[model samples]
Target chain A: MFLPGRRLSLVLGTALAVGAFAWFFASGERNIPDTEGGLDGNGQAGVFAAAAGAALVSGLVLSSLTNALRLPGKPLEIGLDGLNGATYLQALSGLVAEVSRSWRRQIQQYFSG
Target chain B: MAVLVSDYFIPAIFALVLFSLWFAGRDRVEREAHQRAVGISMTALGIANLAVQVINSVYFRPRPFVQYELDLLFYRPTDSSFPANPAALTFAIATGVWGGNRRVGAALYALAVLYGLSRVYAGVFYPSDILAGAAIGVVVALLVSKLFLLLEPLPTIVLRLARRLYLA
Candidate 1:
């Protein structure tokens, strides 16, 4: 429901996808302790935070990628459960248009009155 | 695999799975329901951690690596080992999500079980410790969910405010 435009989703998703793997590899290589007492409480917290971030990033990337890779020639119809970037953009654009029209009408009425 | 999973992989995946539930559902109503579940799970996780800490303070149990001769795959944790914190945290989240979304909750439960097993395999936690942790997590989640229900409109009001900010 909080989907962004296709282009934005693609870019962000790709970045997040790369970031997730990169973080896992980099952190695993450096922070995983081979010796006892190597990881303190703060270090453990950092690892957990990094893991959470990576996971969230990966999930978002997958969701956005799934929607982006849909057939390009197909109609941009919002499905009943279409909770992707495109649908979010569609809804956002609709909201903006509605708000602008209402504002324009209000202004026009104020001037006439 | 045990080392990597025990260290961070499972927790990472668990967070991913839990958050995915928030993005699920066909409409706002469905999404809101999932969001509520996420909120409850997160809250339960926090409380579960606190509960584990309290237990640790009350009773000190040495880690498996300290007492038994086994190839340890994880770092030596300084905390008390009577209740596995990872197991408890994961189970709390799984149980919390289960009340609203069963499928995702089931996946979370599987992951939680895997996490617990990996910790044991890695020579960090005892099977009994993991069991105790899981029990603590499940009981806390159930209690917290019940409390939320008893609180009624308060939780709903908070969610409404979150919705106003486009959070829910």
Candidate 2:
């Protein structure tokens, strides 16, 4: 059932990862911005921001592929139960739950008072 | 601000990485798998960071402090600023964990951004340098995650040796 999804993820992830790497190395050789004389203020920011965006997109796409490939042939469960590690999801959810529980207690106390 | 940027920021980032490791350790059921994944991710990150160094050597660029006199926090480095090393390392780790857990990945990604911005704010790196570094880190991580299965034999051998020594 999930084979098609896995295959699609594998294909898309590989393509994005390869394409991003190629683009970066191919165009990364330009001379550093001549900001010595303060000629192009923020040029560095602009360039780096664009690069960061590209990197982020590539990373997310590739990560999705990894997840898709890893999670097949198993029951779908959220959090870090996939591999048995304390996943980021687990930590974050725990923190959120704790906070929310505390908040709820506080609200109840206030209303009861 | 200077103290935070110079003295505390790097340590804070390190702490974040440690925290992730500690989090992985807390899981009794998937502990082994999580640790293995972390190991794989970190090894990949090291390789990617080394590649960045090679790239830096080929295309040298001065640090922002070397280029301009800004509010300096730490002693200036003589390394190339084309790709920010800190950004690369942090992003690589983030991307590594991201494959296993999205929420954790997102948190690490946020931390990576903060670290990059702090480097820029400290006038140590240019914005583009951080971006480029992050991009490289991401690419390396993705490749590693995708090809991890192919590299399984290497770890399996290490595990066998460790088991022999009763160290695994």
Candidate 3:
């Protein structure tokens, strides 16, 4: 049972961890004497894996800490949007049509001017 | 600044921004929309990578640092420099988010441009490569977003399942 606020914190932590590792790998830890320190194929993969692990650990720690803090009221649940299959299809179709209409209008305006 | 940005800072920001959006929004509706953008961006990124690979296999261009002696800010890469991979990837993400949220999308676009310029400044890629990469990314993202829209109910179904597991 993950609280909404904790879940948010977890994601934020993961993002930060991943970003920090990427920067560190590409910039801070880049000066190797023998090699020019460019990211080769293997190096890139290692960086990604390491960053992911770091993100997971950091996210978990942040979420656990947030849970321990136990902020005042219960957070709101992130419920479903209630858009079923049919409604979902309808919404997409409407969006496409709207985009098309807008494009047409823009084209007309361009030609008119 | 150019070295830091060209090396990894901007790309990292892209990931961070996308991750933040994935879990953002007040209600399920908004959150779902944001997630959809992130999904689209990820798919576009995959496609962009494939495109870059295909192009690299077909056409090989030397890196700017390799072609001429210049003050190189970053390390030398062995990969072909025809279509800048970072540029394509960042632009793909920007375009993907643009379809869902214009403001964020525009901001991403700006960052993408900056990333391309930074790469050029670092002597990793040519202007032509960056332009080509940006074009490929934008086109791929637009096409993927349209395709996702066409495949409507399928995405919604997947999202619902993820939501059930609290993974969405």
Best by TM-score: 3
For model 1, residues B1-168, the per-residue Cα lDDT tens digits are 653555556666666666556656767777777888887888888899889989999999999889989987766677789898888888999998998888888988998998888888888899999999999999999999998999989999888765432334
C-alpha DockQ of every model? 0.15, 0.02, 0.06
Q: Tens digit of lDDT per residue, candidate 3, span B1-168?
A: 643554556766777788678767777778888989988998998899899999999999989888799897766677899898888888999999987778899999998998888888878899999999999999999999999989999889988876643346
Interface RMSD score of each model: 5.4, 14.9, 9.6
Ten consecutive residues with minimal summed lDDT in candidate 1 chain A? A71-80
Candidates in descending DockQ order = 1, 3, 2
- Return the top candidate by lDDT: 3
lDDT, candidate 2, A56-76, per-residue tens: 446435544545544332323
For model 2, the docking class works out as incorrect
**Residue A30 alpha-carbon offset, candidate 1, angstroms:** 4.8
What tens digits encode model 3's per-residue C-alpha lDDT throughout A21-81?
6667766655342256456433653575577558645754554455434433222332323
- Checking candidate 3 for backbone clashes, the offending pairs are none
Who is ahead in DockQ, 1 or 3? 1
In model 1, what lDDT does residue A80 have?
25
Which model is ahead, 1 or 2, in terms of lDDT? 1
- Candidate 1 docking quality: incorrect, acceptable, medium or high: incorrect
